[model samples]
Target: MEIRHNELIQMYPIGYVHNIFKEAIFDEKMYSSVSHIVLKEEFQDGLKDITDFSKIYVLFYFDRSEGYNLIQKRRYDGKIAGVFASRSPRRPNSIGLTLVELLEVKGNMLTVRGLDAIDGTPVLDIKPFIENDMAGDDLRSA
Candidate 1:
């Protein structure tokens, strides 16, 4: 498939995140915090059977992030790495993927633990985290 570098793509948020965090904070507290993913009324029905999974992948948008650096020092370990290699919010697409623990599901709201996104953050999608689906070290060969 030929990729179009200038192509413009658009997406709508399926839900919004609710948490105590008002902005991005790089710390252990942010990753160990609890948050809620509230889906729109129209998308509420899609949560059926989702409770079967203990963990989920939350795809969100970094609405506040402006620009990105190609190479920078990592937050935790001062090791320098490329944008793709580091979990930086500032990126070309500003898309974030976090694997959070699913705590409870009530109505259109999902209580999750360890979501780094701040309150009112737009959620693009959510998917179950399957252990068998993890590529892990196998991805190095691919």
Candidate 2:
């Protein structure tokens, strides 16, 4: 029960991600292939029509991770987690969510694919992962 530091936590990078995941460590068997994201040129008109949703929820900005260790150690087993239940990019606020799978948008760039982020990375927002809310079928359908 401790979260009170307001500046309302703002964000602005509407676009800047192009990946092949150049490298940031974490290739323990290529974690789900499919990769490509561009999104730039004046925000590419926000990629209108979002390709009728195939799946997308990028929200990036780990900006090359910097600090945090509120309890870590869970590569999948050494359990000592609790940095918000471990998705650990070593965070005190590095912000990096990924659910990519738009596949193509061409025009300012957006061909995303299962992003794990880390290749220019700065796409602070891009939602559209709603598929029946009210607790029915979300969690990306599962």
Candidate 3:
């Protein structure tokens, strides 16, 4: 499948992320920090029954990522690797996916831990994280 030259896809943000950290930093500090995913009033109904899950998968757009590099050196190890092999925000599409611990769900708002998205980041969608979503240890050796 291919998109035409003029073809375009559109997406609307259901909510924006709110967190204390302003800058995007790849570190272990986000593990304990809390973040709020405040959704629009119209989308509040979608949160029904979401609190039952312990974790959720958040799909968001990298609104702050400026450009892309197919081959770039990783920040931590300074090792050159393909863009697809690394989790660098600078990607072709600038999309981000992360599994976060769901602390609680309030009307139109979801309080979560371990969200790396910056404040005001657009949230595309959210889904409950299931065990099947992860691969087994045996598969890692394949």
Best by TM-score: 1
Error of 1 at 105 (Å): 0.6
List ranges where model 3 is wrong by over 4 Å.
1-6, 75-77, 134-142
Give TM-scores for every candidate, taking all chains together and pairing residue i with residue i.
0.90, 0.32, 0.85
Q: Write the per-residue lDDT of candidate 3 for residues 22-100, one digit (tens) a residue.
A: 8776757777789999999999998999987899989999998989999999876889989988879999888899999
Cα deviation of 133, candidate 1, in Å: 1.1
lDDT of each: 0.91, 0.75, 0.89
Candidate 3 global lDDT: 0.89
List, residue by residue over 25-106, the lDDT tens digit for candidate 2.
7764334666556665778887788898998888787887789888888777879988878887778878878776787887
Clashing residue pairs, backbone N/CA/C < 3 A, model 3: none
Q: Candidates ranked by TM-score, best first?
A: 1, 3, 2
Which stretches of model 1 miss by more than 4 angstroms? Answer: 135-142
Q: Give the distance in Å from residue 88's predicted Cα in candidate 2 to where it truly belongs.
A: 1.5
What's the CA error at residue 92 for candidate 3, in Å? 1.2
Q: Give the range of the ten consecutive residues with the poorest summed lDDT in model 2.
A: 28-37
Clashing pairs in 2: none
Name the better of 2 and 3 by lDDT: 3
Give the higher-TM-score candidate: 1 or 3.
1
C-alpha RMSD (angstroms) for model 2: 15.7
